[model samples]
Target: MSFLNTLNLTGKDKSVGLLLGLILLSHTERTGAKDKSNVVQKGKGSTAKLKEIMIGRCFNYLGTINPNAGNKDCSKLWEAFLRAFSEKDPCKITKEDYKPFLNMADHDIPIGQSIFWSQTKELILQYTDVTHKVMPLENTLIGFMLDGLNWCGKLSSPGPNYEACPEWNSCTNHSMGSFWRAASENYAMKAQGEVTVLLNGSANAFRENSIFREIELGKLDSKRVTSVHLWIMDNIDGPDKESCGVGSVAVLENILKEKKIKYTCVDNYKPVKMLQCVFKLDRPSCNTGT
Candidate 1:
């Protein structure tokens, strides 16, 4: 099916798409005032500052953050990461810690619970499964409200049409998929110029899309991407082994290599396996146009 058709465009879908489309178009139209547009803004931490948070704390704290894992230091790191997200300040965290904290805040936190600041904190503490809890790296359910979700922004639900799924748990990773959808949706909304969506039956989804190659050629604009975060939510047999599920870091690594992108793996900030790998796409990758 064509991309538009594949979107499952019903009347409601079209209307929603148009609304988002208008928002995006408005940002692009102001290209003349690009220097001053607040629609997008740079993240607070530098590459070096981010590195300190990730390698120093996030990786080190791993299992402990799960609360159920019985690791005191880990719990501390988890709390720190959660706080960084809620505060939008990475003073204590390093590069590694930023991705998961930001991702969870961006995609995983429920929109309804986002209203009250205390409520957001409560949800993070509640969902953490120290033993096997799949805490979100991003609050993917909030859709276009990612910017609004930032602690600095006006906090509220996206709209009346937007609500947390009632049967979220019964639906595939439950709320996890919602988080992914939100991240992907946020990216599409923030992108300027052309944004292409592709699906491949091939195991190498990245290759089929030439995502890395396109980025290198500058055909894929960097300002739109912000940062790329991934989660490997699976019961893999072992480390360096297939999880029987797709989207493994090994696959992403190979694609990055093929495209010759200069990427550094952020360490320490979050659960390595659960939060998995995060990549900083050279310059302007994480700008996300604010």
Candidate 2:
């Protein structure tokens, strides 16, 4: 048995013991020879800080951003989220664990405006910000609060590990992956009228195992979804890898068609491409004002 188990420590005992071990290890590392290469990366702590950020964003969503967003209590939402993975093995957290949390965070997505993208996230961000006429998952309340953050909990305690969370590839039910899967599934289930996806023509835009393909596509309801639109964009100077009715684009179209869904694919969509050229306006291709 481990030292903690030998002592019959439980609950707070084990938590404090673990924290002390981390502090001692840090001191030892500091006292030893400096080695930047040996630096350790850590997942975000699920503590007051993460809670504060979540709550703040929740209130912002209900107030400043979209006052019409469904009624929700930020504190209770945090409790539901905490109840999802707390005291569970990080690698064993299934998407189902977050169902309660997703239920609580649910809000209506504006009709025909949900934007899904793969491999071209930054481009989509610029596109959505410039247009503000579309809504990416990242713009939603849950995604807004947790974007770029990592969190995981432990089976041995009721609180988060605050040390190292499992890497997404470590298991099929990885904590972070589970959360996104549940969120993406929830988002897809709520999509209405029209759906839009942004894809990079330079790369394999359609990955078989992406969240968009795995969770989102299958969950889309034909009765509720009217059409799907694919914006296949390539860099200004390009070895174009894919486009409408070509390459993986063909694969995506086939998938949607097999589902009896209507779609439109545009290659290097002009408005988004124009945003890309903002930084390189002096380029020959960008100098079109004759």
Error of 2 at 16 (Å): 37
Quote each prediction's TM-score: 0.21, 0.81
What's the lDDT for all of these models?
0.32, 0.81
The candidate maximizing TM-score is: 2
Evaluate model 1: give its TM-score. Answer: 0.21
Ten contiguous residues minimizing lDDT sum, candidate 1 = 110-119
Model 1, range 33-70, lDDT digits (tens) per residue?
64232222333212233324433443333333322323
Q: What is the TM-score of candidate 2?
A: 0.81
Query: Model 1, which residues run further than 4 Å from truth?
Result: 1-183, 188-250, 257-260, 265-290
lDDT of 2 by residue, 1-290 (tens): 67567667789899987777778788878755332211222444444467787888889888887777778899999899888888776767888899888888878899998889888889898988888888888888878767877777776567666666656676788788989998998889889898998988888878888889888989988889999989998866666888899987899899899989999999878888899899988766566661
